[model samples]
Target chain A: MASTRAVLIWGALAVAVIVPVAIAAHSPLLAWRSPVYIAAGLAGVVAMTLVLFQPLLVGGYLPGLPRPRGRRLHRWVGAALVTAVALHVAGLWLTSPPDVIDALLFVSPTPFSAWGVIAMWTVFAAASLAALRRRLRLRPRVWRLGHTALVMVVVLGSVVHALLIEGTMGTVSKVVLCALILAVTVKVLLDLRTWALLARSWR
Target chain B: MTREHATRRAFLATGAAAVATLATAASGLLVPARAQGLAPTPSMRGGANNYLPGAPIVERIGGGGFWMTGSVRRAGDGAPLQGVRIQIWAHTTEGHERDPHSHGATLTDAQGRFRLEMPQIVPAFGQPHGHLAYDDAAFETVFLRPVMPSSRDTSLSADFVLQPA
Candidate 1:
């Protein structure tokens, strides 16, 4: 019975992710949209989807993978997520330099631009911190606190950015992905018991 | 009342009317001229179509085996729109955005259905989005459709219902 329940849970998770993506694949706003823009849009979506996996991996939610393996995968996935983000921004830059410039400056007229930039920076910061953790000789607890905080910023900003952009991404799928990202992130953070260390640090 | 005052008043009124007319004309020019019907914005990243000027404007391709099928219909009446010229292009299976084999155009049949036989596309940008354009300039054009990849067959299908022009 327990195994059956686990299978059902995993099945639900897969459906939650796949069904939305399938729906998104069905309706693209334009039939002849430029490949570059399509690529950029796809990169953004891929990056956002990767956010969901981060929590799953970190929380050891995947059945076969042990927590150590999950952590290793989480690191690799994080790198992939960052790469996706870079490609997204770079692709957009190639398509429209002026818009990318405006977005970078945080002066783009589009509301979504600001959020995207924020998310982009946060992701970079998280990656940078991860790379520097050993060099900085930071305590594990301290590192966790900072990393967790940055991850939160990344997820929140990304969610807002994705939600705001009325682009090629199917609306229902994008929303479901964003909601799951937030929910899973929160759940993983709670499960990791980061709060206890963070709270104790305050004293 | 006085002849001089009446003439001055008439001149001022005529000047005001002329200014108003000029202002209206200027504002009309300032308003962005929309394309006939609803035309979607072009892709920012110039794709294969942008570079391939020598390519055929309309190709007699898209039939069987590996294909993309769709129907164009009137949104309100549920009527199929026949003879609508539809252009389509995608990244080739090898993932070249500029591949010629992935580009073509055809007309919809009487049933408002079109079948485009394209290469087994490898989505270079993550997921493949096939670019499309309708022949009628007066109807609003839908730009891109995310063509779902299938493992079982090298075929995909989509339907377009156009808004009233």
Candidate 2:
């Protein structure tokens, strides 16, 4: 019975995030837009939403998820985040190559473009560094510091970018999601007690 | 997990989902189209016919902003066709679709050359594209390929080769 209940809870949590985004996408302004553009925009929203999941998984905050399983899922979700970002950029590129190029070059006239680009590269960099962590033989403390720093960049940049773009995303839902993402991330960082660990090690 | 704990978890999870859904819906969040099987139109379509017949002719060359250069030609003969009318409409720097300054036209020179200057437009979403059209006496209205912005501050070029229809 408990196991069944756990499954129910997990399902509900997933639905909560998805249903809102699905409903928020139905705007009259988007009626005439192309599928490629829609896909690009949706991918960005998904990527930003995924940020909320990362901290939860890493902190083992989800009910019934073991730490090991949560960590594994965290890695998988991080990779998925990268793929979403790629698809977001690729779909946009298909719709307009010049605009994509400008965003990538950090010369786009939109303020959101630069922030989005920064978050995108930081996500890629974080993933690459994580993959090389074992090979690089870095100390856990050093790795944690670098990874935490990049995560902050990803979170801050993504939040700003999403907020600045007054596009199809429903403003209320977007703000709520962003706020949750920031709160969860900060909570996870505090739970890690990285500073405490570093200070103890130094002593 | 114990039966009691499981029940509590389920209750909390269900409550969370319900709250989120209600809040989002109350805030007017509605997804219009499903993601799958959308029949997307090609990016380039005909330019908007917003050009007034007696609209004042504007010389786009040497004006500020991005410069666009192109030539009108006969499709089959590869011959430069002079005096073709080219129309352009683009989003403003603020990304407004109804921008007045972004809509205008110019006539091809003796060498079938035309130039247009436009502001650096940034779309709120998707990609920014400039609409274009070419008109010649002997050919059907030719909509030139869209003029897109690039990474560098450089001139954009397009050539309209109109087919007789």
List each model's interface RMSD.
Answer: 9.5, 10.0
Q: After superposition, how far is residue A143 of candidate 1 from its true place, in Å?
A: 0.6
Off by over 4 Å in 1: A201-203, B1-165
| Per-model DockQ against the true two-chain complex | 0.03, 0.04
Off by over 4 Å in 2: A1-12, A197-203, B1-87, B91-165
| A1-203 per-residue lDDT for model 2 (tens digits) | 87787788678667647754775488544554467777888888888878888988999878866678999999999999999999999987876566677788876656788999999999998888898999999788788888888989999999999897756677777888888889889999899876665676542
Displacement of the residue A43 alpha carbon in candidate 1, Å: 0.9
lDDT of 1 by residue, A86-125 (tens): 9999987776565578678976545677888898998898
- Give the least accurate 10-residue stretch of model 2 chain B, judged by summed lDDT: B37-46
Give a tens-digit lDDT track for model 2, residues B53-119.
Answer: 3224576522348766788766545667677777765544432333355566788888889887765
Native contacts present in each candidate (fraction):
0.00, 0.05
How well does chain A score by TM in each candidate?
A: 0.91, 0.90
* Model 1 Cα lDDT, one tens digit per residue, B1-165: 556555777999999999999998897798644333333333222222223323344443332245777878875556788887677766554333445655677778999999877665443333444556553565665554444554335766667777656
Question: What's the lDDT of the predicted structure labeled candidate 2?
Answer: 0.71
TM-score each candidate. 0.54, 0.57
